[model samples]
Target: MSRRGLLRTLGTGAATTLAAACGVPAAYVAPSDRSRSDLSATDKRLTWANWPLYIDTDDEDESRRPTLDAFEKRTGIEVTYTEEINDNDEFFGKVSPSLMNHQETGRDLMVISDWMCARFVRLGWVQEMDRSRQPNVTRYLDPQLRSPAFDPGRGYTVPWQSGITGIAYNRRTVGREIRHVSDLWADDLKGRVTLLSGLDEAFALLMQGNGVDITKWTADDFHTVCEQVEKLVRTDHIRRFTGNDYIKDLSSGDVLACQAYSGDVIQLQADDPDIEFVVPEEGAELWSESLMIPNLARHKANAETLVDYYYEPSVAAELAAWVNYVCPVPAAQDILASAKDEETAALAEDPLIFPDTAMRKRLAIARDITAKERTEFAKRWNAIAGL
Candidate 1:
């Protein structure tokens, strides 16, 4: 069954039973439990770097996040949260030198897209978490995110929230229902479709269109899709490759269909009722931006505490409502379902936020490209993108 169908059939029930047995080890323990703390007074304050507009912000002020403030008040740990990360590759380039040298990133806990997190773990630039202090994580992380190809046991990272890379189209402009990946290549979409320029964002769905399993996809599978996209590009079937600017284009009717992230589509839907998102029948990539401790963080314990604090169902619910992304804590879905406001309550039923079992099955975390593969893949993708 398609991932969406799985969700319609299983709903919240599957997450209840499947979450525990996901990627986490039954007898697993974090290395932090055995390590000694070397933190000092200055380390009392930990720096946390995250993507822009990722967390819950005060509705009007935008400067305050009630949940984060409460965490600091209760724990007495100062958190310097900065929305400095604008793009994954840009952030990685900025911190690459420090990470390669094992120097402090000046960030105790940083949130990065999982694919990049895999690079950090592979480079040994992040710390392994202590599971003893993170019982909430061990018990509460959504089953789907438990064991990704990059971090099988998920010892190096934990998801902040998850989302889908799927198709987004303005229904009024397109005047048709787009229900599958093959629809993007239809003649009707010629010169009216945009795909993401970022290789990570664009590749998986294309692979799925060819009916390849992403979890264990091969290099040949990648090149095969690349050649197909090259053919489309040469024929001018694609409008252009883009960044987040695709949102602007879609909103303005300059583009009718494009690849999009689920979180961004939620924002678009608020103003334009015609904007629609769909998880293609062939499957879409289920990706996450995760939190991890940098190699030389001074407050690993405090960071661990903060990570666990967010796992509580109540905390997770508040965040899920604010960010409008897939919640990693299944228990939080029940919380939203009972919200007092109809608007908020409706979010609980949104399949994008808490995908039912069928949707969960269609969702797969694609393997990260190796550095060698990246060079070759980027060359091909950039050529098609006219970069």
Candidate 2:
């Protein structure tokens, strides 16, 4: 789904402030104690919390979700799904009490942006999956997505969908190709460039433009990006920092180029072909809104089965066609190519969704800002972005 809420973004939109809502818990959870009493063996049901408009629906019946229904029918497992996530912080606030208290969230499986997933993983508020039960995920999950710095080997999380943070521009207004991040600062784009207001969504791409290794970026790397942003703010080179509102600015040609999400630009191009998204020559960040089995869930086995079921190439392709984010299962591209509808088949080749080899080489997943780093970083970034 294209999240339109001011705070709703592709990943954890609250990088700096997420931890402030709760002073970092002094207690840590041992791995042996994270699992709750399992009910999957006896109960044929599980609950899933996710964002709205995220799954493939039947064309004539919005009530029916095709892949989800298929999974229920195939496994005799009933999934009671709810679209309860509107804002990342709001959802975190809702669930943190239970996760912090070591109680069940009453949800078996839930999806949250990977940036937030890092917090859950770090605090040991989520349980690791037994990979032997997720063979499809093992076989089809994209290798590029396998080892994010926050969750090495993905022992505790699986990506639900993926996206790229890159540059977007209106070719007609800019009157030149924007091949690198530096182009956003060109004299032609002065006072006509925008950036994402959220700290997490904005920093990695900016750091990448400076040739920093995002996966192992340091305190110095972060401050260097902040210093440049502070200068740009002083010079009026940046018109504003916004959320998805950048879409409106780009569409109106008020801004020639700005940092943008791949999926948002694809939708923009359908209406205005002049809009373009670039994974800069330096690189871009590939991030996900991922799924995690929260602390103590009764349906761990069923949730694991459901997670792996979505990893099946055919199931993943159906979802890719609907939501139009980067698909985490690379093999799904082939399934999309053979889709019955020609347009759907062509989507299989969209470099934004299934980026080709050349583009893949320029993408990296930056390590998430830690709880220790959040306070200082958020203070600096929010001050500069004016959020």
Candidate 3:
């Protein structure tokens, strides 16, 4: 199953509802209380929570994650890794109580979508990582991903893997090339194109389609896209709203073109060469599911060490090979290029994995929907998409 297939359909509604009931001020943690005294000097272990199938797992024995095993071996820090995160809002609901109370979540590290990271950063529910200790990250992190609107300079989050939100189409089935977001609206694609259902997942690319600057898109810009999408839905121009199931539709030829993630397209192309993913001429949303250290994490220093270790070009290349997402470390491209395995070396040249200069020019990380905007935006979006 694709990673997104496991995501909950509710999006951020659950968390937003909880915040409304409890009141935002009551849940906010003061900055001084966000940290706890470090135990990393003596505690040689840390627990990490992440999404399923995210890390590099051994083919023969799925229990063994090569990169993680190497981290344990190289630095005597034993990691207790759990694939416990299934959805962004679901996971947020799971841990928000502890975070709101300023208590340890019993997790040293975790990964979630950057949009959710913005929520935690705003609530002061996560600790800022010390970059001085993360030399590889400081040197190799992609410049394009360095300063998202929520976490300027990436002070609180590190991208675990990145992907592009763009258009994916079966070229032969479509019988034409799709160069812009406008192409999906062509009369030929009526009742054949699908869109993402989740409010956070669907909005930016649609706004980008209208030539809006997603990084600083205004409320008027958001409502304009909503109006357009509502019209598409009413006229059956869109077959339906979808989650990751768009992959199934496209693969089965039910849909010819749809909004898709870059990583999923890579896997699809391996099976059917006709599958093509495009960063539209107007632009596409560059997004990431990022790593973060929650407030009062007991092994903060040990977790920081692990984060830096993965930033090393060689290590990043190995992880990138298996995960097939955009590598946050661009330096890893050279490492993959020099690998002995032919298939592995070819990955170094995949623009989806390491985007080319021209492609990079069109990629932008959208500004996160704020606490003030999420409820209103999600309500309008959910009503239209029927989520």
Best by TM-score: 3
Clashing pairs in 2: none
Clashing pairs in 1: 3-358, 3-359, 4-359, 5-358, 6-357, 6-358, 7-356, 7-357, 7-358, 7-359
Candidate 1 vs candidate 2, TM-score winner = 2
Model 3 CA deviation exceeding 4 Å by range: 7-26
Residue by residue across 107-157, what tens digits does model 2's lDDT show?
Answer: 999998899899889888899999999999899989999989889999999
lDDT per model vs. reference: 0.81, 0.89, 0.91
Flag regions of model 2 displaced more than 4 Å: 4-20, 24-26
lDDT of 2: 0.89
Ranking under TM-score, best-scoring first? 3, 2, 1
Score candidate 2 by TM-score against the native.
0.95
Number of the predicted model whose lDDT against the real structure is largest? 3
* 10 residues in a row with least lDDT, candidate 2: 1-10
Q: Which runs in model 1 stand beyond 4 Å of their true positions? A: 1-37, 40-43
